[model samples]
Target: MWFQNANSPIMEYLLFFHDVTFLLILIIAIAVFFFFELIFMPTDPHRFLIDNQSIEFIWTLTPCIVLLMLAIPSLQLLYLTDEAHGVLKSFKAIGHQWYWSYEWGQELIFDAYMTSIPYRLLDVDNRIKAEMAIPMSVYVSSTDVLHCWTIPVLGVKVDAVPGRLNQIFFSLNRPGIFFGQCSEICGSNHSFMPISLESMV
Candidate 1:
């Protein structure tokens, strides 16, 4: 469950960035622990513990450099992933107490309720295609309380607030079944309200 299988370009980039940051953090942590070990049990009695300007500079500058390395790519990904420059499909998702209602750009609207049993793939795709186009742009909002629309593999999540529209843009890497759920706790049946996306070619 902890492992992530990325399904889109945004998700792939996010996973790569996470690994890079984790590696950098691990290296820094190990180096700092080693330095502390040396200080705590120094073999030389004359080893200076207080007045090390060079060591201080190195620690400070190293963190700044690391931050820069992480920040630059993060900012780039933020802009690149956020704006749907060439979005062809559009949708609106509204959150209710325990279910989700979706409206397509073509004016088709419906409510989706979760179930343990899976629907036929062809039927699901046909229904979705009757409403939306590929590479969708989704707008989110809540009808009652706050909710979070999240699809982990797709690398898309946005808040659904009352009277407020939050948007996310994503393209399906391939045609398949993707699942998600309301990330926010809105009501008693929140767990039952799952999301299913059937992307068509």
Candidate 2:
């Protein structure tokens, strides 16, 4: 319930997977508790005296099936997040010690610093603007220490390593402003390095 509303296809898939896995876990826990109660009843003194091979086999196979169900979809989502083909727009996000800089091509570049005005720490001096319904690629790197660029609503997070470049792909489904912060602890002002993105049609 605390999760932010999903604004992209990947985020929707992530939310669906989370709900399905949670339901599976709840069902397994309840079933296990029920079996424990039935097996350990005080009135059934001979409960441990009998064993059924069929029941043993069913329990063993059930867990393996459950594991497969969880694994297959998880692997698919992982692959989906990494696929960056046919990206219409590409940009670079360079993280600094306490701020973020963006390059939208050779012609446009700017630094986004934290502001204390309307949105308080969540607001920035400049926001990244882009169109919706277009596949976009973002290359992330760090200029100083380690940092992470993240946007939860879009389900995009990539580490900004000092010497290496990491990339993430996503398409926004709606027009709105999304906020995220540096997930990695880099310095004393780590919390002040906020990320703001404004999506449009």
C-alpha local distance difference test of each model: 0.77, 0.94
lDDT of 1 at 96: 91
Q: How do the residues 50-124 of candidate 2 rate in per-residue lDDT, one tens digit apiece?
A: 697777888799999999999999999999999986899999999999999999999999999999988988989
Cα miss at 153, model 2 (Å)? 0.2
After superposition, candidate 2 runs with Cα above 4 Å error: 45-49
How do the residues 100-140 of candidate 1 rate in per-residue lDDT, one tens digit apiece? Answer: 88897665888886654555321122123312235678899
- TM-score of model 2 vs. true structure: 0.95
Q: Highest TM-score, which number?
A: 2
lDDT assessment of candidate 2: 0.94
Report the number of clashing residue pairs per model.
Answer: 0, 0
